[model samples]
Target: METILDKIIAKKREDIRNMTELTINDLDLSREKRSFIEKLRHTSEMAIISEFKRASPSKGIINANLNPAEQGALYESYGASAISVLTDVYFKGTFEDLKTVREAVNLPILCKDFMVERKQISHAKAAGADLILLIAAVHGKDALKELHEYAAELGLEVLVEIHDDEELEKAVSIGAELIGINNRNLKTFEVNLGTTEKLGPLVRQSGAFLISESGMKTREDVVRAAKAGANGILVGETFMSADNLKQTFRDFKVPLTVPQR
Candidate 1:
């Protein structure tokens, strides 16, 4: 029986291969030469990178209009640490999202996509991205290492995502200081906060800026994750589903204040 991670990884390898075939004349990253992503100097200050995502493999019709720049502007306005933009075209997203967001927000913009090859590294630079998310399940150990290194050399930050304890090892091995724990199971599309609960300790061991991703729907979940040692939360559905994203971030800042006992 294959896990969700297994299937997504296989799918990414094929998706990336096809995307590379596109010959582009518009993008230009000619003067880019910095390893911003891998540079340990720039630490993830403030909160988790708020993701301006449109849809996912599991959930459909998340947000069609998804104005990436508008969302980024909102997240930045509310004092978010970074903005994550989904760039997988098949997933109803595009690199244009990151480009637009990067232009609007002052914070770092994470290129959240099904990354498998180096083509995306160049895409990040050309599109004005500050960070990139590399899913460990979709990349072999060697490939993950190489990709992280490559992204680092370009002055970009890398957020290595892991679904389980086993994958955490791979993330650390590749020197992934910024880590994202996804709760949604890739194969069955099931979600359980326990995934983050279980992996929290492992990530803490490595001292990475840990973020809990997927299945995050409520402010209570955010507070719970913080208790479990999570530094930030990468959310999409809850925030994206809103009509006013800036208000959503403002709402998130309260973190469900409890009544006095």
Candidate 2:
């Protein structure tokens, strides 16, 4: 059976083929690199990498009228440690959105997309992205390693996303320091915070910066993740649909030292 992730990857390959060459000169590489790891490492509170997501494969058309630049700035003002811009067309996003956000904020920017090619890393670096996502489920161990190294070569950090222990081991084998445990399963789109609870400790034990991604809606949810040993949380729909972005961001910024019950 073809999953949503399979369909997205298929479309992405076609998009890459049709993509026009984006030379380094064509992009504004003048922006200084903001370190995503450094920002998270130094923060006393649970770091929040707020996302500028227009939609998702499961949830469609979330705040379609949102201006990426404005949203990015708002996230910064609300104490976001970094800004993540979804750069996949399947998610109703584009690289233009990442660029716009880059121009508007100085926070570390994550280009959230299914990265399979080195050229995509080049595009991400040129667009002023500080980090790029590499999904372990989408790439073989060797491919994942190659992309992780390639991103490093371009001075961009890799947020290796893993779904299970096998994928986590693959990320660990690649010496991935930044790992995002996505709670929403890409295959079924079913979200369970327990995904983080189950995998977060292994990541923490491996001495990697653990980021819990997706399905974070409330303060309790954030607390739950923090207790699971997440150094940071990647929140999208909650922030995008928020009537009060500042409060919502603040509410979700639980202390990393949150006491376990």
Q: Whose lDDT is greatest here?
A: 2
Alpha-carbon TM-score of each model against the true structure: 0.82, 0.95
> Candidate 1 on 136-234: residue-level lDDT in tens?
877789999998997776767788999987789999988888888988776687889988888876787787867788776666677677666676778
Please, what are the lDDT tens digits per residue for candidate 2 over residues 67-149?
A: 89989999999899999999999889988999899989989999999887888988988877999999999999999999899
lDDT to native, each model: 0.72, 0.90
Candidate 2's TM-score: 0.95
Angstrom error at residue 21, model 2:
4.8
**Residue 222 in candidate 1 has what lDDT?**
73
Positional deviation of residue 207's Cα in model 1 after best superposition, in angstroms: 1.7
- For model 1 the TM-score comes to 0.82
- RMSD to the true structure for each prediction, in A, is 5.2, 2.5
Give candidate 1 regions above 4 Å deviation.
1-46, 243-247, 254-261
